[model samples]
Target: MSSAFGATEKSTRQVSTLRRFLRYVRPYRKQVPIALLCVLIGAASQAVGPFFIGWSIDNLIAQGNLQGLLLALLALTTIYVLGIQAIREQIVRVGWIVQHVLAQLRQDIFTKVQSLPLSYFDRSEAGDLMSRLLNDVSTVNQAFGQTIAQMLGNLFSLIGIIIAMLSINLQLGLVSNFVVPLMILTTALFSRWARSRFRVTRKTIGELSTKLEEDIGSVREAQAFNRVQLNIDEFDQLNAANRDANIEAVAITAAFLPSIDFLNTLATAGVLAYGGYLAVSGQATVGVVTAFLIYVQQFFRPIQILSQFYTQAQSALAGLERIFSLLDEPSQLNDAPNAIEMPPIQGEVKFQNVAFGYTPNQRVLNQVNLLAKPGQTIALVGATGAGKSTIINLILRFYDVTEGAVLIDGIDVRSVTQASLRRQIGIVLQDTVLFSGTVAENIAFGRPDATHAEIESAAQIANVHELITTLPKGYSTYLGERGAMLSQGQRQLISIARAVLIQPRILILDEATSSIDTRTEALVQDAIARLLQNRTSFVIAHRLSTVTQADQVLVVQGGQIVEHGTHQELLDQQGIYANLYALQLGSTTPVNTAP
Candidate 1:
């Protein structure tokens, strides 16, 4: 009983998946019936050819009648012409529909990818996502364009031949159909096995692709660590698995086709033997016997083609399952139904008794509360993983607080659309990221419509205008992937320039100058100071000296604020903040301790 329930449940899920896939074809509904009609007409035309040949041999040739022969020949020519025309029409119409469907599917997949939360990317492989978008979509396209029409046409042809044969000679027709049940049984069993194997092949291919993408992206690290052989061995294992999966699928197909052909051959022999006997005993006319022989062969031809289509359909369905699985991933973050556009304000941000975690059991921030008034510079200093970044993430609503609220200007951050909220905030990270584009484009990324004068002015404010002007093409100079052509400091300068161009009401410099040399750090720090002018700013830095001038310095420890005061006040207390400051500045003098 349990097994039966499981099987029923599995079948129901498959039906649901199929129904979802058919929704993509809903828009092309009008064209579909027309395409199927063309297929049916083409099959009928093809089925008539064998009967005409038989008629010519028996009624015309056997009678030695010139008029009958001439008439039969003309009829045969007309049938061939109609059959070719129908087949051509079917191909043209189905091809257009398949291309249109693929385009729509790809567009939808891309849109879904963009709408998904950043957390989705954190846990998923880029290559696997790409495989679903490109490789799997192409597989479905092949099945729709080629296999669908062929399968329908073959079904119609099989039916037409069976009917024509029975009308001509019932005994021969019965003999011709003896192996069809066996063919059906063989196909059903083989297709089940093939579908399972093809699914494995597709999964293995995705895994292999994921491995390749990971290895290629980190090839430099592998070389630096002298782990080239290790990576190669790992790649070989994945490659071997992909090969074995493909071989298993191919083996099933290899065995399936010939089995159908053998059954067809057996059916043909049975028809010829029975028809010949009937003809000899004068129970059937020569033309009837002749037509049965031709019709029997024609009947099994479609069965063979249909078997092939079934195999292709299995592969295509496997691909469709993966593609749809990707599309079905729920967006973890979505705007509220009545979410309002964030209004420009003084940027007075506050975290009110907020508690949060990336997962349910592992709380990363606990009852955190803080406030940043308009135009105030708040510096967060903490050991790594001490919830410094989590505060920033909450402010940006990258992840919502599990309890309590994060408010900006007395309004809940979640109450506003993410785009409008983020648009008003500017961030420059420790690791600078720039797309492949002109120097001007990277700086104008946030405000694409900024004029050349505004772009140059922003660059000048970031102290990178002279450097950019020295490049080969000045503002038009191309930056390669992630701005590989520029030094680390240069990239950071451009990032600051980008933030300045936005003219944001809130600014976050997350270890923005930590990795630069003293000279570059001075320039970046000066630029950051200018950018923070009259805007609420949060500075996360390891260097205590950077925060000495901040309006308020927060020393975070174990996801809680251990000390909070102005820089000199915290140092005067000689607590965690003083120790960190003393260590960084190499101060060893004993100081008075205060609570």
Candidate 2:
């Protein structure tokens, strides 16, 4: 009873998956009926082909009626021509519907992922997501585009053939169907046996794809660390697993496919033996027996096609499951219904008893309180994971505060739409990211409408103007993937240019000058000094020297501000800030980041 219930549950899940797939199909439903109509027309044409042949055999051949035989032959040929045209139309219509659904699915996946909070990406794998978008989607395309259309046409043909056979000779048609139950039982057993193997094949494919993406993305690290052999061994292990899974899946198919053909042969033999006896006994005409043979062939052909389609459906359903799973991920950053756009800023920022955590019931920041007046520079000095970054995150509203409010000019950050809140802020991080675009394009990323002259001016302020102009094609030079053509400091320079072009009321620099050498740092720092004028700024740094000149310095330790004041005031207090500065002065290297 449990086994039966398990089978029923599996069957129910499959039905549910197909129904979900059809929801995507519903938008293109107009095209579906056209394809189905074509299938029915094609089935009708095929159903009568055998009848025409029997008519020609009985009247024209037996009686030697040449003119009647010619007419029957011509009619049969015309019906066949129409059948072929209808089948062609079915394929064309179904193709359009599948392509459109796939396109919409891809678009929705991309838009959904982009809207989701960073927390989702922090736990997800990029390679797996890419596999779903590219490899899995392609699998669905093949099954929907061809296998579904063929399966539909075969179903219609099977029904039409069964009806046509019974109309001509009842007893013979009944006998020809004797082997059908056995065929169905064989199909069910083999399909059940192969189902697990097919699942393994899909899982292995996803793993292999993820491994490949991981290797390619980190090829530089692999080479640098001299772990090429280790990588190869790891990849080979995954590759071998994938190979074994596919082989096992194909082995199931290899065993099952021929058994279906064997059943078909048995059915055909039964028809021939029974029909021959009927013909010899004068219970049926030779032509009638011949027609029954054709009908029997048509009936079994659908059974065979259905078995093949089952395998394709398994693959397509797996793909659909993954695609829908991505779509179901909530955009945790969505704006509230009553969210208002933030107005231009006066740059005052206040954190009131703020508390936060990446996970529930675990606080990363606790009882944090601070205030920065307009145009003031606030520096956060701490060791790695001291909640300095988390403080910045709260101000940006990347994640909402748990205990209190983070406000800009007395307006809670969460009360404003995220787009409007982020627009008036400029940030430059230590690790810069540049897209595949020209030099000018990267500079004007924050302000797309900025003209070429404005881009050049920003680049000049960032001290990267001469460097970009010297590159081939100047502003029009295409940067390859992630700006691979540029050096590290150069990319940092471009990022600074982007932040500079925005003219934001507030500025954030997260170790922004860390990548540049001493010479470039002097130039970039001067430009940054100019940019910071009349703007509220937050600077996070590991090196104590970086924050020494700030208007106010807050020393963070263990998710709380251990000390707060000007650099000299904190030193006079002889607390954590003073001790850290004394230690930094004694040590040769800067403090490190969180692991």
Candidate 3:
């Protein structure tokens, strides 16, 4: 009894939430009215059949009228077939419109996800986002497609049946209605508890999905580290939690259903007893009593439907909450009102006294300044986490500097459109990402309209044309996701080729050759030379060989440029760059004068 009492209290809260959830359906009011009209017609057909039977029993049989009986049977058959067809057509059409509306909603969600900045991704969990995109959207789809129409239609049917029953005989109708309010009150109370349990189930399912994705993606790592059992245990725990939540939700519904069924039986018993008394007293006709019985049955059919709708609506409410939450999230960053398209760039890059951090009070770059004149190649060398990548990110406007300015062509980068800025720059990163497509497709990703000849030329300049030809399909070979079908060195070469194919005014090489063998690196040196010619470039690498080729080398320490000069000039100074050079060279060599 205590457990049942607690369940009732919890169910009350769920009913309130479900009521709030219905607000999302307000925009579809016009279609809803037509659909309801169809439902009402269908429900009216149910009561119509009972009247025909009553007429046959009380009049047709007494008069021995064979023609009237045949006509009534034919009419009943026609109404059943035609009404069912009409109802089906309306239901299917409503479903089609709802599906179309859902597609637009899904596209809106995906667009919002893409438009958000990097910081949003940095702070958000991949699994949580996936839940909203996949699970939540699906939940809402089911809700809109089925629940909304049924809820309103069942409600109207229930009301119509009650009115028809009273018109037949008021005392019997009143007796049948006695248990309805009780059933409704019980359901209203239990629904709140059921919804909370369902919400827990939904949340658990999302966590499980996220964990499964992570585990599969890192199966090798898990096995190698002997953590597979640990992961399995965690998954089992989540699965168990999800199971309990679902069972609890099912239990609430199961218990309430039996109580409602008992109440309905009690109503039917009262109608039978009272109608029989009225019949004996000659106060009501036997035909009227018979029709009233059918009406009572019809009345409860919609009640049962309403009970099921309550369960479905609860699940939909949970989905709506998650969907709205995702839509409510603020974008990582937005353009200023005065932001304008950047002018044609000459690729003169400047960072003046820049300070930045991924989060507040944790500086990554502090008081950092650098300059690259048009057609100059600057190399930045540092230990890991010395802010080399942060500088590149700032330059590309993947992130903005916390203080000061990043200027391109003497204009502040923040003052211009990021898309315009990026179109003029090309990047090759250490972890090369290639989409699943032919070599030509990957090379043309940055410039989708590039000619076939242009793609071959870029591959040739990158010195990978010969290797690509060696493959069975040459440039047409389909690379797997992230170019997993190719070797790391081969993927890096493709990335470099892609960058060169873009032919941007500015190029960024952030350890572009870090994954390749020395032979391939040496072979690609000329390609790098051709790629850098007359283009402003920032190259981040620890390899002394690559650093020495730069017009200027900047040795960054603790987010500041501690030393800056040509290779020989820096070696003469015997500072951070010289020490780093000697460390890689294994022995210090005499500094040679610049050419």
Candidate 4:
């Protein structure tokens, strides 16, 4: 009884998940009809071929006429040629239709994921999301591209064969028909077992893919920690499970087929024996008996095909459910119904009692209030997870504040279009990200229409022009993945250059120089000085030295602003800011230059 309850629970979960997935197919309804039409035409061509064979055998031989034989050969040749051409055209058309539909499904899933609130990414793993977009989507396409049309065509052909059989001889047809129920029962049982196995097989594939993505993305860290064998063992466990699941499904399917073939053979023997009895008794002709044999062969051929189709259909449906589940997730945040565009103006930013958290019922930033006017620099300093970065996030509206208002030029950010608000800001992150493009292209990413002269000017301001010009292809050289070809400092410089080219009203520099050496830091600092001119800026850094020139520096602790003052002012007060500055100074310089 407990086992039955557990099974019911598992089935409920699977059904719920599958229903969520079918939403992805909703957009491609029009394409489905066209694909089915092609399948119908293909099936007609297939069914007609066997009849043409029977006609040549029966009509030409029974009459002993050369003219009838010649005409049958000509008809067979015509059907063969035209059928091949029609089927080929339909196959190609279906391929094109599947590509477009799959592309649309992928695009929708990706766009929806992007629009989801920051909390979604906080709770989700990068590897899992990647698997949904790539592996799961590919599985859905395989089912649609290969399995669906074949299933439909086989279904139609099976029905046509059944009708043809009954018309030839009722008793022979009844004997052949007996196997149909058994075949269906066998298919249902095998498919039920295979479906469960395929579901597990696909899930194992996802887990393996997720593990590979995480390990490869952090391969350097894994190597540093000497966990290479550990990752391999984890991967082996998943791959082994996947192999077992697929093998189990194949074994279950193989077990059903031999029984089906035996039944088919027995049905064929019954037809031959019974038809011979009728023929010798003068109740049936030789030609009728021959045709009945052909019909019996036709009957089970489509049944074999139907069984194969049913197995694949189960797998395809499972894949579709996974893909659609991703598509159905609603975004956590969206634009307000009457949201207005942020107007161009002098840079002014304000946070009024702002509070936020990645999850509900827990606040990471509480009642945090601050203001930054045009050309002013505000620096935030705190211990790790003290909501220093949270302040910057609220300012950028990456996640909306739960308690108070975040304003840009006195306009509520949430009431304005996100695009307009983001356009006014330029960010240079701690870990600089560069695409697979030339130095000029990376620098001018924010403003793609920027000319070569404009790109070089920004690069010069970021102090990267000389370094870029030294490359073999100058500004046109292609960067490798994530700009691995360049040093850490060079990538930071490129990020800065990209930001500067936009000429944004506000700038964000998050530990922008933390990854560089002292010499490169000095160069980056010079570029920072040039870029921050006449721009409102918010900077976060572990090194207190970077905030010395700021107009206002705030010490954050426990999600609140504990201290706010100028560098010298905070030093004199000797509060949290003073201790942090002293700690950074003690760490950055050696005691007495040698101790």
Per-candidate clash tally: 0, 0, 5, 0
| Residue pairs in collision within model 2 | none
lDDT of 4: 0.80
Please list the Cα RMSD from the true structure of every candidate, rounded to 1 decimal place. 2.3, 2.9, 4.4, 4.1
What would the TM-score be for candidate 4 when compared with the true structure?
0.90
Q: Which ten residues in a row have the lowest lDDT in candidate 4?
A: 586-595
Ranking by TM-score: 2, 1, 4, 3
Error of 4 at 31 (Å): 7.8
lDDT of 1 by residue, 196-277 (tens): 8888888888888899889998999999999999999999998999899889989999999899889878877887788788
Q: After superposition, how far is residue 22 of candidate 2 from its true place, in Å?
A: 1.5
> Against the true structure, whose lDDT is highest?
1
| Predicted candidate 3, C-alpha RMSD | 4.4
Q: Give the TM-score of candidate 2.
A: 0.95
What TM-score would every model get versus the actual structure?
A: 0.94, 0.95, 0.89, 0.90
lDDT-superior candidate, 1 or 2: 1
Question: Poorest 10 consecutive residues of model 2 by lDDT?
Answer: 586-595
Candidate 1 Cα errors over 4 Å, as ranges: 1-10, 586-595
lDDT per residue, candidate 2, 25-63, as tens digits? 888887777889999999898898998888779888999
The per-residue C-alpha lDDT of model 2 at residue 517 equals 82
